[model samples]
Target: MSAVSPRPSYAAVLRIPHARRTFAAALTARLSYGVVPIAVMLCVTRATGSYAVAGVVLAVFGATVVFLSPYRAALVDRYGPRRVLLPMALLYAVLLCTLTVAGRHPGASGLLLGVIAAVTGACAPPLGPTMRTVWRELAEDRLLLQRAYSLDGVAEELLFVTGPLLVGVLVGFTAPAVGVVLGAMLMGVGTPAFVMSPAVGAMRGSGGVRKGRRASLRPGRELLPPIVVAGGVGLSLSAVDLLVVAFAGQRRLGDDTVAWVLAALSAGSAVGGLLNGAVDWRTPARVRLPFLAAGLGVTLGVAGLAPGVVTLTGAAACAGLFVAPALTTAYLIADEAAPAGFRTQAGAWVNTSVNAGSSAGAATMGLLVERLPLGVCFLVAGGVSVGAAVIAGI
Candidate 1:
């Protein structure tokens, strides 16, 4: 009988030192995101007695981050992450403290909450880029980076799964403000701790500004376009995400369906990211861009069919096929586009673009959800995806 080979473990695939640190950082940051939804809802509801107001606050908060992520990223590359991280994190913690105290007055609470959200968004630290940078700096090969990002995606999904539940318990048993308190504590602990690590500070005095600025100027490079494409893709994805939940609820499916559907989406994205990482061929963005767009278009377009959970999940997977490759492509482009001095900021620009696109897609979908069928929303999202593909191909 032939001997069978055992499957390799993920850690073996990555083969990097202090990789667990990155994973730990991702966990804390993601968990912090989970806390925000609960905190915002609680803060707005207790003070204004209106869920709508609370939602608006959340939207505004997200918008601020989406808009500012690029700038913050640039700052990280220019000045090094440590300089940018501490101040922003400190500001965010301070805002949360203010929210805890100002919870009673509705007018005061709304204003404070919005300010806090904006500050938090701005100060959220350059985590995604910083983490990626760390992987690039430390990992022996591209394969390791792929594993790092895949693990990051999984960690993010877990955060969504666990963060809200913890928040619910805290709010239900104690107070919604508890979520804020917990998030702040985590942010305070996590952000600074990561920044203070010797590996991170070692890069601090290195050429952050010189490299970042050069990358920002080169338009012919791959980085700028992918970031643009990703932003649009992110927008569409966010819309589909919310629409799926809304449609499920309308069908009288339980809230539990939301988690399941989101899981499908996350699973798809993770799979796509892993697949992209595994491929060794160094394909140009122009070649890869169409596939990414087409995959998203098809996935999102089919989503409007509003099939059973199984069908919807399949569509989600199809759409997600592009997620990681597209991102990888953008990062590659950024690497090419950025001079040595501007590497980090160029990467951050890509991150910012994605956040902005997601914000736009969510807003546009919200408007559509009111007047159109859920299926129509899916079609619209798909069409937009197709358009993005065509544009990216050019």
Candidate 2:
């Protein structure tokens, strides 16, 4: 048999000099994501004594991000990420501070709190896209970029996991508002550094995208597939989230067991993303993407039908294995497909679709979970994933 392609070396990847700083800053910025919603929930509950009100406040933040991501990204493409990133990062902190301070007072109205949360999210810096842009700028070649994307995907998974844990620590040791406060601090420090890094500066100075290109909802003439596919991934994830909680409740798993089970799913994705990155693929990303999307849906369906936590975990892992590979490919494709100067906007559009899809999927799957068996909820997620595959193929 032919010897397997050599594993991509992480040491080599990190040796590029600019990589470490960008990675550090990107990870730092990501940590805040975990803290914000939970902190907002906690802060709101503390002040209003109503989980319902807190949930609404959090939802407003999510909705605002979905709509505003593309515009913010367009600005980054126009003026360079620093011009966009620095100001937004600072504003994000200020908004968080406003919300935090307002949350402390009984006189703060829900409308005021919700408005603050919305603005904070709407003006949030395009750090996620900016980092992806950095990777594209820094990677030596397509293969290296593939490795970078895979590494980035895995790191993101870890960030999501760690972020919540950090917030938990803060909430336990200090106060709920402290979590949001810390998240804001992370953004304030991390985003500016990330945007100002040498790799980012090189990207801005390269003048790849035209200075005056008009922003559009269109990622590019060619980017619609990846955008839709990303949306589907988001849709399935939200459904799986709800299903996992329902499964834990149905099985009478302890309060904390749900967290573990969810963590297992994410753990599987992280492992899969790392492994995928190490390989040299023979398949074109476009062909592989649909298969992976379809596979995730099927695996998730099977997992939903599983009878025990062990089986469910196995199934979840199988599905998770497909996620990063598909996402990495999509991001690569987006880079290729984006109109010149619209790189940031292209990433933002993909993000916007995913967030929008998530909101829709969560709301839709939520209604189904109320009426259907928990196993069927997995099937629903699978159906959504399959639809996403169809979009990818289209």
Candidate 3:
């Protein structure tokens, strides 16, 4: 056997021709993941003057887009990214434009706007997962793949933070609808470029990859365990997010400070992800995955009990450190566990599960905070983390 070469760094990884374009595309696509909510909120507020209406509208979009993913991903597998994504990207753009027009026109019906948001979002490009799939195909080694996933997690943290910041900037500089429109325009550019990339064209696929059919509607049982773990992770993350907000409110920190505090949590995660990428694990993924996940929960549980802002910051950082490693392990394992020719479906299910969990987290913690102390909300966040650990362990 030939000797193996060292895995490429994230910077070097991007220097590959197709990788650069797809990486850029993935950033925009994933950026939209966070951008859409704020954009929708701002658009609705500008048009209807009701944040409640905007929240409801955005919630509908989030709920719809997630559940529809498996089907959409199946299409990508069936027709390939070019045929499927091009149309979806076009439709998504049209919908955003339509939404902008509807919001600006007082004569436009709310029902029409809701329909636009729901359908447009449901059909949005599967940018994040698609990029992961492409990266796996392009990776030179398992270690490289793991590094790619860590880089993905890091990008996700930055995208989420940056997405809202960009939206706020757009809203300040232009009409509220401008943010949504700008997001859609970026999608229009990125999706087509990603699909048509010469690099994507050269990647080899297993002959088993084929068109999805009605009979293929259900994913293989191999996916069940990891998807459950992913959902739990998603749920725990959402709970932690809300709990942080509640913590900030309790400490008499203004809205302006909330982002600063959350930045500490995100910064820790980025560092952890970077370190994970640099290390080569000798342990089995099954053992490593659950261990990291459970360790995360334990850390979060202890941190939730912190009595002051300084303690809370340190605790959040401790919890944050585990976030990317667990996620990277889960993704790697899920890819291994996916059935033949069904990796896309498996990825979609993972996405769906996490999303479902996040929805539950928001709703569950929202209710808890209404009747229980803010500390209780933090405890619940920790509990959810533990629950994720258990599900992943099993």
Candidate 4:
């Protein structure tokens, strides 16, 4: 039997160059995203006046992202995340400017906004999954990779919590366009550096490892597992987003409400990831999958009972408890599942799944809100997460 190497000490784990770059990248990416919840919604609200219209606009944006993310991932795989990331980042920034300028033409605004959104969506950096791929590639120590994922979870939570509030403040105090421009600049500056870090470059150069490693990293290989897992998880996450909108719309919550609820959930997910990394649970994922399912079931089920924004956010937080760890594990699984030189595809597939799921969730919930109570929407969203957990179990 092949002996698995012993895991490294905490000190040793911290020394890995790849892990540091990932840490830096995670900080930047999440921080940039933090500004999005407020910036995007506020832009729509200011332009359209009606919350439903804003919601529809958001839904369209989500749809564009879902459809285009796979192609972006393909680029990442073909040229490396660095090669695609800078141009994509710059294009995203330009689109934000376009969205800002197109606001005055109500008749043509929606179409122009949608077009710009699609462009930005196509360029949205593949940081989350790409970073995960880098972690696996650069960190020889499994423990370090695990830590990086866990830290990433924490960073995501921080971003979601703080990002929207920052955007909200900017929109409220300054201008909606400011938020977009700033978010674009931050993303453009931060993501490219992360993608181009020395550590990430080193991993890209490992040409003659085991066949699986070579094939997974190769530019033109089909890696199906990451695609499946990413799609499933992304769909589940999208459902969660729909529920957030439902809750916000139901309570007639202001533009800031969605950001708060998402933040609450993010906090829980961050905690879960941190615990998972720290504990270094020796058990198989098969053992952990059931618990994740139960959490999803309970969290989503309770969200339906939320009577106000506070209760809704609370329930959402509970639901979030499973998010990061599940996502991180899914990335790992995708890496394991992919063939040589195809890691970027795996990451891209994950992004595509999320974008797709977000679009579907937004559309479904937006319609559902037209006919049902917010609580019911939450229940449905929660149900989606539970369903995802159950499917993962199988």
Candidate 5:
């Protein structure tokens, strides 16, 4: 009789040596990402006394962060996190402090704020991709690696949710700039602790791209499928927020109802991420990618046909069941496709695709929601994911 393989669990992933400490430190710094946006937005709005200026500032900030991610990740790949991440985090923290001080007083120049915000975004450390790189280093077993990524993804999801609520609590007690200060402190403290971890130290020697391996760092055909699928998933998911709001308004649902519907989508993604990790599948991640994307696309398309809020919520949950799984698979595919010494850059590209798609999706959906029927808008969004899956599968 063949011996049975043990079922993988989140516990096993955490049990890997240094995994707990490294992940904790990474999360501590990453939570700043969740906190900084809302805090900065409110701070800018208060100082400039114009939502329009605040909006433009944030747009500039986000554009730099999203579009420049791959280059930032390359720095990590070249110098390793120890040499690169600490300086980036320190510079990022200092910039945030400068912004906080400048924005503490009213009538701060919006143009100056925009310049600062743009530089700040550019300096934002690529912690997420770096942490994922560490996970790759720590978990050599494929099955265990899957669980690690899932846990990382799920925890990240919660951190973003929690970050905003934490800022909300901070604002109740003091100014939003206080929240920005807190974000700076988190990065200052957490990043040093993360780099000191033994696991990260292990990666130091493997920093530079080996000769003849430089070409592998470039986005090749193997990397394209995951990038395409990740972008599609992001594009589809981004529309849900606006679509849900429009859906609720059309049905006269309360704000709380809208919150619950959106919450359901998050809850489903969390559950799906865990289950996806737990399964011991025979199929490769690439084979699973298209199917997962299709599942999301199909469910979201059906969601458009729901007659009531409750039914719409159910459909949204079903569609969300595939979100984390698809992204996880995409990351897995990207990791596999990337050669040694370039994992961070490879992961960053996938991350970039998701953010870029999200930006496009939001702009596209905003236009569509104003002109087209909401149901038709949802179908259009779903079609994007399905179309991506088809292209990726080919």
Candidate 6:
């Protein structure tokens, strides 16, 4: 008689010795990323008393973070996270504190703030990619690895949502600089805890630096599909935010109504992420990725045709369903394609693609909304995603 294989579960992923501890510590550090953005923006705005300066400062920060991400990840790959992460986190935390102190007084120099923000961005640790690399090491079984990625993705989504809300609550009582200080504390405390984990300790003995130095820096052709699809997914999702706002405005709905619609999108993504992880699919991840991207594209296109807010919310929810699964699959593919000693950098490329695409999408959609019909803008955004999928398939 054939033996029945154990079904892969999230509990099983955590049950792997050290996984729970390591993941928890990583999440603690990652939460700082979610908190820092809004906190920094608010602090800058308060200091400069000009939204224009605040916007430029935030843009400089984001540009550095997004563009330098892969290089940061490469450092982790070469030096190993245990040896590298703590120092990076410390520098990052110190910079945040410095920024807080400098931006506390009104009429703070915008140029100085921009310089500090840029330096802070450059020093930001690649904790997310490093954690994903640790996950790859812990979950040797393919199915279990899928679950780990899905759970990580869902938790990350929640962190970003909660981080902004947390900042909102804190600013009601304290200054915005306090929120920035809070983020610094999280990073200062969390990185040491993460690096001390036994899982990370194991990596220290592997001589990743020597191996990483020998590995080619350029990503191979196999990585193209995931990277391209990830960029497309980011572009479409970013554009959806503006499109929804416009959709609400055209119908005379208030900003509160727009929140509810966006809430549906988040709800759908969380549910879809959980479901994607739970299933034991026969199809390979590479085979599954393009189809997932296409599903998102079609749903987003249909969202443009919604006659009412309710229908639009439903369409957005449908689009959200594909968001997590597609990105998760993209990460999985990138991991598979990565060379030995290069896993962190491989993951960072996918991450950088998503963020860079988001910046572009937001700018493009802003212009399109002024000149084109809302429905047409949606079509253009969706079409970008579909085109990416087609390119990946070919």
| TM-scores of all predicted structures | 0.86, 0.95, 0.92, 0.77, 0.96, 0.96
Task: Compute the lDDT for candidate 3.
Answer: 0.75
Q: Give candidate 1 regions above 4 Å deviation.
A: 1-9, 12-14, 104-109, 205-221
- In terms of lDDT, model 6 sits at 0.89
lDDT agreement with native, every candidate: 0.70, 0.81, 0.75, 0.65, 0.89, 0.89
In candidate 5, list every pair of residues with a backbone clash: none
Taking every candidate in turn, the Cα RMSD to the unseen true structure, in Å, is 4.0, 2.2, 3.2, 5.2, 2.1, 2.5
Residues 25-132, candidate 4: write the lDDT tens digits. Answer: 656864766686468767777776767767666666666655665556656665676667778777777787777778744443665666676667666766666676
Q: Which residue pairs does candidate 2 place in steric collision?
A: 209-341
The list of candidate 3 runs beyond 4 A from truth reads: 1-6, 106-108, 203-221
Q: How many backbone clashes does candidate 2 have?
A: 1
| Local distance difference test, candidate 1 | 0.70
**Per-residue lDDT of 1-394 in model 6, one digit per residue for the tens?**
1222357788999999999899999999899989999999999999999999999999998998888999888878877897788898999999999999899799999999999999999989988888899999999998899999999999988898889889999999999999999899999988999999999888842354463255334766899999999999999988999999998888899998889898889888999998899888788888888899999898999899999999998988888899899999999999999877888888999999899889999989999999999889999989989998998888
Displacement of residue 328 (Cα, Å) in model 4 is 1.8
Instruction: Please give the clash total of every predicted structure, in order.
Output: 11, 1, 0, 12, 0, 0
lDDT score, candidate 4, position 8: 52
| Poorly placed runs, candidate 6 (over 4 Å) | 1-6, 205-216
Candidate 3 lDDT tens digits, 1-394: 1223456677767766578877877687667667778898888876776767777788888878899888777776666677778899899888988899889954446667788899888878877767777877777588788788889878987888888888988877788788888778878877877877875565333333446324233755556556766776778778878887888788888875566656777888889888878777777777776667676677777867878777877877877787777777777877788655456666777778888988998889888887887766676676766776676566
